[model samples]
Target: MQKAQRLLDLAALLLRAAEPVSWREIQEQFPEDYGGSEEAAIRKFERDKAELLELGIPVRWLQGDEDLPAGYLIDKDDFYLPDLKLPPEDLALLYLSGSAALAGGDFPYARDLAHALEKLSFAARGPGASEAAGQAARTLSAGDGPGRGEVPSMLEELSRAIAAQKRVHLVYAGAERSETTERDVDPYGLYQAGGAWFLCGHCHLRGAVRTFHLARIRSLEVNRAQPRSRDFQVPPDFSVADLATREAWEYAVHPPERARVRLDGPVSAEDRASFGPRAELREEPGGATVELTVTNGEALLRHVLALGDRAELLAPVRLRRRAGTILSELARRVR
Candidate 1:
């Protein structure tokens, strides 16, 4: 039998044994693999045991009492993962995120990630787990889109660079300009936003911190000189959260204006938080009115439109007029 297969069978036999499996039993199970001289067979077993230990499976030897014989066995508790009693909503989000990463085709560890998600689903217990898993699976399949053109190998390289605090050179496509430029960046971290992967880093070309979309990175090369050493240190004050949590409307394209918006229905705390930190809320009978500084009028208008009839832009007459004009145009298109 092949060494890999023999090792697998050995592990299975030890795991399934109610009591410690004797060495004689293991040899009998794989006679061919253990049929050489006694010393040679023992040497082979030792090698297999070492390999299993490296794989995180310890083959423990039991010193039996008078009744039980001395043997080897695998503790199920040691081999198996503990049950993660995650709430249904949290589990669903994990499932969705994993599925999205796989679907995006940019994540390098696709096979390993799939196995992990399977294990996550299996380890999930408690009420509503099955329902949540099912819902998440359905949601992922329903929303599956055409595969993106981003390279998975590049993403893998970037991940390595981030972990090692290494610098990278990139041929990046500009969003506004129809051109690509060479950039030398010290990568800090990678984040997912709006179903896309972005790299947050210190750009040498811009002489500042910048975020680059993974898809927009035409090509990249990690600084390979002194590969074992770190290229730069991430600043103590810099945080990926500050950049990742920013909403589209928070990206200042125009001068800031105090925009008032009325939410005429039940507003979730999450919704309120999306209005940003500067937002002031005044609660009324049925709903609440919010006043916040807006910098991206187009993004704010789009956000209000997504909320359907529940949200209305009350102040900033210019933006209100633009929203009205967009609605009118949309109505015309539909008709």
Candidate 2:
């Protein structure tokens, strides 16, 4: 029998057995695979056991007593996930998020995520649950982009390093520079923004925390020393949420300046909250004015431009003039 078939058969046997299965019973069931010299058979079984453990199926051994025989069995409770009992709406939201992550085929573990979504679909017991999930999947898949070559492997390696708390050495191409530089980083976490994956870590080269775009990582190596032990600890105060929520204008590119914008159209609560907590808002007739600190004036300009007539830059005379020049250039191009 193939190793995969043998493993599956063994798992099924153990899961359904009323009591722990004896070594003799296992040997009898898979004599072709388990039958050999005593040492060889035992080694084979040990290898299979390790593989099972790696697959998250723990095959536990039980000690024989006067009345009970020594054997092995898979604890059902340990193998099966508990019912989450999520409502249909929440399940739909989860399906949407998962589908979005997999849409472009860029995620390294897309197969694993697809399997998880299948399991999640099985758990949808409420009325219209499956329909909701299907709708969400359709919405996300419609916008799928071409696969990102090589980025998947880099992401996978960084994910493993992050989980193992191992530092990584990287050959990175800077966004603003032509030359590539080598750096050692202790990866804190990974996040996706603007459809690109980024690794947030402490860079020994810069002696500070920095974010590296996965596409720009030309090469990398995770520390191999002490394979079973962690090489570093993530700082307690470090939060991926803070980094994920930052807007383009918030990046530290230029000297910080207070900028104001007037919103003429009715703003949704969600839109208002998009401005960080540091923003101050004042309500006026027919609209509101918001003042917030910005470090990238061009980013702020683009944001206002995207909002069209609904938003207007109100302060920092230099940016206002720059916006006008950009608008004029855009008009000239269209004309």
Candidate 3:
């Protein structure tokens, strides 16, 4: 069984235990698995405890209190999920929605939602928690979709830090400067915009909320030794969408200005979507012109370059000339 499934089983057994159950009893119940030679069982149990703690599940060992022998169980009060009062029908609908999203790979919070659904399934199915848990896991892990090929290690780490309300230090490469700098960030949330993932957080270095592209984050380490309590609190009204409004060239830290680009053919859905709603399109004799408010000159130039002969930079005389000079240099080099 996967460790996740085994952990769920362990949680169930502990939650239902009327009193602290001894290690020997736990061994007897899970022989060939949790049950083993005395030393092996103890070590295995210790590892399991660490995993549960890491996931925010509280497991406590009660030292032979009263007349009872020392043993382990999840804190019943802490583990008790608030009654959501959703009937089986409601839960089934949620399960279907979650499963479809996972299969389609469009879900931004796939990992987080998958775990929540598993726990919810356990709560909703009651006596059938085992089957429901397994089903939920299978559904969410159906396939490796786009951007899911390598299992976004940094994204996972950031998600955990967000949940734990921990501060993190990031070794980030500046997009335009190509300089690496370390910054301490208090992550508020992770968001997916267009085709990329970004972390919205408070940057101590910048003294502001900044969006860091996941691809640009060279490394991250959570500041676990700060203190027992959380180092920062996301303002109650804070939202990731607030910081995610910038697009393409708009991400450049510069005064924004409008620029026009002419395309030789109809805009593709992919291109139109990437430009977002801020762009205005006007039809021309042979093609179309798109007006965009840009903050990053190079970003706009890069996009136009990617489109090759299909795109032309118009107006913003300076930017257009810059694009032309670069193109001319490329032509000479290739010749």
Candidate 4:
């Protein structure tokens, strides 16, 4: 079976075609990277057409010639799917989720998403239908979410700074630390995982876009004199999933060999959920051992903090030393 491509690619192909295209014409646009024969291509095309049609792209069967018949082509003007908009069918789901977010008072963005849903739902729904949607939404969010809050607003602030090429100064207080340290930043971008916000920025102190925790930001202000450069671009070497994991250590930069860690039973599921995609895990006596290469010391530290007592870094003498430092500080703070 063949999987259809993203509609954006198909739209670009269709727009470039000179005339009404047959199935073969569409097939030619398939990149060599996508392995499929003409017949296989047609199957994928049909699926793609269906998906596009669902999203309101005007792909249809053209009236046939009296001569030997040809297949369909997308309408020239309507070949592309409109901007990303949830269909009427999806609006119901969005309302339910948004309603829950509103009830919890955690996600402020939910109010905006809900308003957008209301506009769509009004057009699609019948009378009294919206009332039912509200009730269903309430039921879905009955359980409380213990996940960290304030992440969304922090991401918003970082995003603004990145767009405006602005510098921001903030006081960061670490999990175990008593005092706050002020850092001036060249804001690069924001990223998220597991309900946490990370500000990727050139920390004036560190002289790099070292990831900073939104939770640790005790105070914030923008610097007016030292604006960001228009040419600044984030490197492609890092990512959200890599920088946020639940093991004793997790990071993306490929090291000489992936550092290995052994985790006890209690935090095994938590560890697996965050780092399992990158981890090569092996079952050990008490729990599981996970292996991964890392470059971001901050991400690794965060992972260690997540496990608290359940994780043990197996190899790399430097990591053990860092772990000792963290534990020593934690010990002092607790007792």
State each candidate's clash count. Answer: 0, 0, 0, 1
What's the residue-level lDDT of 275 in candidate 1?
75
Query: What ranking of all candidate models by lDDT puts the best one first?
Result: 2, 1, 3, 4
Q: What is each predicted model's overall lDDT from 0 to 1?
A: 0.81, 0.82, 0.77, 0.62
Clashing pairs in 1: none
> Model 2: clashing residue pairs?
none
Writing each residue's lDDT as its tens digit, candidate 2 over 238-266 gives: 99879877888999999999999998747
Tens digit per residue, CA lDDT, model 4, 1-335: 23344577775565565555676555555665234676776666676777777555666666557863565656655743234355656655655655555554434334344444444454455433475456445534533344434555555456656766778888898778888888888777666545656777778888865778787888777756645344345566755445554333434454445566778875546577666576678787878877777655546656766676778776667777788888899899999
Q: How do the residues 28-106 of candidate 3 rate in per-residue lDDT, one tens digit apiece?
A: 8878677657888788888887788767677888899678778887777777766667776776676676666555543
Candidate 4: lDDT over CA atoms?
0.62
RMSD of each: 8.4, 5.6, 10.0, 14.6
What would the TM-scores of all predictions be? 0.58, 0.69, 0.56, 0.44
- Tens digits of per-residue lDDT for model 1 on 86-140? 7877766776777776655666444455556655666875444454455445534
Q: Of models 2 and 3, which has the larger TM-score? A: 2
lDDT of residue 141 for candidate 2: 57
Model number with the top TM-score: 2
Model 2 RMSD in angstroms: 5.6
Model 4 residue runs over 4 Å out of place are: 1-115, 119-156, 174-177, 223-241, 245-248, 251-271, 282-335
lDDT of 3: 0.77
